[model samples]
Target: MSEDLIDEDEGPKKRVLSNSQVLGFVMRLWLRRPVLLAAAVGLMLVAIGFDLALPHAARMLVDAVTAGPANADAAWAAWALFVGVYLAFTVIRNIAFRFWNPLASRNMKELTDEAFKKVQSFSADWHADNFAGATVRKLTRAMWGYDQVSDAVVLWLGPAFLVLFGLSVMMILRWPAVGLFSLLAVTAYVATTLLMNKYYTRPANLKSVALDSRIGGALADAVSSNPTVRAFGAEAREEARIAEVSDAWRAAALKTWTRFMDVGLIQNVLLVILQAGLTGLLLRQWQAGRASPGDVAFAITSFMLMSGYLRNVGENIRMLQRGLDDVEDVANFARQAPQVRDVAGARPFAGELGEIVFDKVTFRYKSADEPIYQDFSLRIRPGERVALVGPTGAGKSTFVKLIQRLYDVQGGRILIDAQDIAHVDQGSLRRAIAVVPQDPALFHRTIAENIGYARPEATLAEIELAARRARAHEFIARLPRGYETLVGERGVKLSGGERQRVAIARAFLADAPILVLDEATSSLDVETERQVQAAMEELMVGRTTIVIAHRLSTIRSADRILVFDDGRIVEEGRHAELVGRGGAYARLHAVTQGAAE
Candidate 1:
């Protein structure tokens, strides 16, 4: 939601992934069901062989008819056998397709799921440096490309290869010169396809996809912050920017397709030349009585089939390149190493020691020029109530985040109950601490569901109790659907105060040993804040609590007040002591009092 989180500057262009990497990505999915893949391949090969043999059957029927009217029975029998073979392989081909499609579909689902999980696992730095829209678009396109490439390899290109091989063999058996010519034409088509794809389609398609992602990111960035855009009257500018990018995308697409068209034209011309030459040669041979009528028919069928096959080869190669281009974006994103990961042999945190110690910690945000905290050490005793009073960007939120292991410290250790967090399982470490941020985001779900999010297994009665404690139950009960009312995206259907109450209820439901109140009541009205304050007071009875607040009035009862300035604890004492001392905390508190008056 922060402007800093939207990375607008386009970095260096992404290089297309190697064909081998793309193939490896595709092939790895087959490893999941090797038997199915093998069966499919075997069946496909047999089917392709039978399909190619149909042309030979035609040749055989022509030869049988040309032999004499006495061989009519033989011709009819041959035709019947050909029909039976065709029907058999059609059944086999359908079965092979049935098995292969599921494998491809399942593979695609797994890949997309893995990428989504990986994105969620990524550190704050990775997210902050990437655009959410661009990342999502890349993942979507990558998944689609994965599906296309898988289908092309297993369904299109795979069969094409077998068909071509079988056709070549059949041609050679009929005429050695024709077989060699067909093979040469195929070889040339493939070479041209590879060269053209490498130099033209790959780069062009990559540019096109890149532009599309940028447009997607830009559109999302503009639309998500609709309130800001509308308030600032920047709608026209946003639309113009989108149009510019979209036009560029169109141009890029056209360039790639135009190159494909050129390649197609070249292929068509080459095929025509090959066809003409082969047909003329066959006719001359037939005139000299060196070739039979069957040979002529076979030559025509083979050339027609080879022409289409060669065209498809070009198309498949382009598809492979396009797939590689699309996946390259997501692969780059997934390759980002998570900054915080569970250490080897790490154990889940247990118990409620409720003690947190920052031992000579050093930390800085990725985008910041200087460390927010360096050689900073602090200790909060079990059930201690500490208030962190600081100006914006004084490292208050960062401290809480580090304690929860949302981001690890750059140097030194953050220990919970004397156990180093970095050495413990992240999930367990977070489980011990519950955070209620200033702007708590809620999913679009029922009020009860949102409140029970932290403890998914909590019963309705338990949820209602937590809501009552947070002063949220009465309002929820008043809604038409009561607790079942749908909170629209980010809980926008609810007022700020209601959303805050739901967040408080969620925290109450969590009941963790340590609590972080990051200006939790900042959005509530004075009356609601008072009620929530009472609830928080009750919840804090036996928990180690860290309260980050700018409003000094809220922390009057805190046992100790820490005044942070420039990442250092400039002043620390009880609220009354700091007020009497007339130091940093006293000055900050005075500003709040003055502003209130």
Candidate 2:
């Protein structure tokens, strides 16, 4: 797998959380449903009490049988008690799970929802550096990992250790030596498992989990760009690349599994020592007449109880460790606050005037060596139409980004309608600005849903009006499903120009005070481009509009044309005035004109 896709040192993983923090994250969710948690814990205690009683009941039954023929009634009574205790334990344990299962499932549901919402809230730069496929893998894996951890904590960890300790104490009260051995043996077994899982198997498991995320990311990257691969006939290349990642995953996973198996050998050896030593100690007591046959029976039964719980404890330790490792990334995500966040007591974006101002704004991308804008000041009055012209990476797109508050400036501030954008609710601020990108992205939903996304409350009649205005209603009406048609992932089912028109319709529905178009007609054919162009002119009316264009002719009629070079405005004028001056805009126009001819 590519290091860029899943490297923990980069992007979101820069704030890696420890295992304990992950455990706490899971605990907080469990703590939310206190009633169910209490019920589960109480039932577990009841089940353990019944389990401990079984061995004592076995002693009474054995003694009753060995007493005499007259003791038959006594034997029958003890036998019934034994079976009843066993039955109660089985039923109670299952009932406890009934409580536990729902508690776990609900937490899983909330965890996934919270994780997705956080991912959505991340800054654009964060999303740019992370992989969608990898993020999905972590979120889904964390859910199951959470379930595993909760299961061990409620079912195995709580009951296994408690039952083992009770059995040990019970044995020690009768024969101090035998009880002491049982206690030490089980303690040593649990301790060894924890140490081995923590120090040995954990590292390997973490590597395997990371590789798993990478495989998901690699597959998503390839499949999402499958059309491009087909066009270039690179299916074989993609196959080989995926195979390389799969092979790495296989190696890491195999190593981790074998380490677990290796650790199991130690647990089996410890159980054997406990079994042999306990039975041997009982035989010594019997030979000295200090222990009866019933005592022997009790000792054997206690060892059996110890054996089962000891095994579960070892497995539970490994499971808990692995679960925590899988959950680490998501817990970190929760702890690492979003880079772009609303201020405390932030108000909604104010005013409908569509006035934008950049006051001495100094900004740079985290990954860039130099600032994009330094002490930059600009103002666009309400209802002004401004065109930005610049080469790639000359800060044209960033100008619009700053207006939308996608990234905050390191120095100074941006204001929308006299309100500092950083001091406003991001949702309200964005709702007042509509953006149409050069390459528009749409959901795999009905065309109506996609257009209505900008304004969820829009009625079908309103959607149709917007689509017709954007010249999209005619093509959409011809589809078999009309407005209800599903536009595949990212609108792949529609042509490029059709997708752009749908995007335009969405923007039209937004009805925001400020409009931004990033080469909106870049995808359309000449005829449709002209139609949408005229429609866009109408859409620009009464709105503060900023257009970024490479085709100089498209913005020739802009109220003001600002030619950006590096981070400064090198030329500011209308098309004729700028062309006559022969500056940066003039050279671009000359180049464009030569290419067209």
Candidate 3:
């Protein structure tokens, strides 16, 4: 396992990325096409500039109207020019928005795709530690949140700053009182939002985490425990459990909603106070002959514009907080170091796989305190059919996993063809081996597709040939759609025996030099097991076969049998020799024979 797989002792500290860091990461990917980003920013600036100029033009018109008849024509012409500039700004902004929005969407899609690939590349151990639904939610939420941030920066924030700055300049020019009022309103809005965020942000994040946990737990439970639920006729019980979780999620959502509503109320009250103060100041100025009706009208218009911008700023702040939380959640997964990463410059395995040697191998799952195997060693030569016989929890299955490199050993080296498997490219090593797990996991795809998954480019004839070799073609041909029949989720549509056959067919098609079968015929009836055993024997003829069997009859013809007890190999020999010796293997064989009788 890599060093990063172990959890740190710092406790959860709201693993957040700063706005600048987020922007930098986005730009690193987006700025590769500088022309697009530059054009988008340029058009936004032009739009803001034109939007800012309108308020000033309104103020100029007010001044001109108050000055006398000589300024009437100039005021009307100024209004017309303002209208023209505003329209041009709208057009340019729309054009720029059209170009930038799609690019941002595309960038988000690429990021999502890359994150998904990284998740798929993660070792099985990582999957065991994390929930699948939560990982998916994180990826989706991050992509969406990144898009919102982009929109806020380019569209919402840009326009808001333009309006605020313009109002400040105009207030200074014609009505200083209104300018101060607008600034105070902005300050109040910012303060209120910041305060609300301080109280609500953590809860909101906790709510999201709780909701994700509920979802992941429910999904995993429903799928994995369907058999138990059905057998016990507990559908209503399961539904009630789901409803309970759903209610909790809804209550959490309401808590967040209530906080948001409070923020909105506070903002509305602040806006009313600021507007009333500005209006009173304007009236006093008008009474003193310091301002005109037109000046009051301009101030009111600027306040309306600024008020709308300020409201959006408030909304964006809330979204920005949530976005950061989402991004952090997703980045956590993307940034996770794999537990079983290959060494630098790993090489591919070349030449025939001669012998697999386990040199004092030891392993333990991440959650376990004690190792499964301690100072254990085993060696099997090429073309050896070795049956590993052991009681439950004797580490037989773990041995198979170690050989496949699904998990790295904690101590000692595993050698394949006299070279350390750790030094081999993971892909090449996996390609050289095939495993038929005790519980075969099939995809939700067609029969042919599932078998062909091992070699996607295999011809239909090749698939049929492999199926025949695995004793699956006969049953497949009888299905309604034959090779095209969909297996449904986890091959639920097929019998356990049939699913095992499909798994065997996949292994047959893969044609790896090293094959591992973990109770491959355990699910089959006697007649079916006989047929599958024949096919398996033929397939194992020229390969290194590691068979884990509870039924000693299936492994009776093996060249060697290793009896395991408490993670150690207690006995090793052919079935006849072991039986003659009357050791662990003989006792195990007797127990199995008695059970069968």
Per-candidate Cα lDDT values, in order, are 0.81, 0.89, 0.79
Cα distance off (Å), candidate 2, residue 346: 0.6
Number of the top TM-score candidate: 2
Query: Residue by residue across 481-575, what tens digits does model 1's lDDT show?
Result: 99999998788889887888898899889999999998988777998788778878887888999999988898999988888888999999898
Candidate 2 has what TM-score?
Answer: 0.97
Model 1, which residues run further than 4 Å from truth? 1-16
Of 2 and 3, the candidate ranking higher by TM-score: 2
Q: What is the lDDT of candidate 1?
A: 0.81
User: lDDT tens digits, residues 212-252, model 3?
Assistant: 55566576667667988999999899888778777877877
For each candidate, what TM-score against the reference?
0.94, 0.97, 0.91
Tell me the lDDT of candidate 2. Answer: 0.89
Task: Name the 10 consecutive residues with the lowest summed lDDT in model 1.
Answer: 1-10
**Model 1: lDDT of residue 509:** 93
In order of listing, the candidates' clash counts read: 0, 0, 0
Give the candidate order by descending lDDT. 2, 1, 3
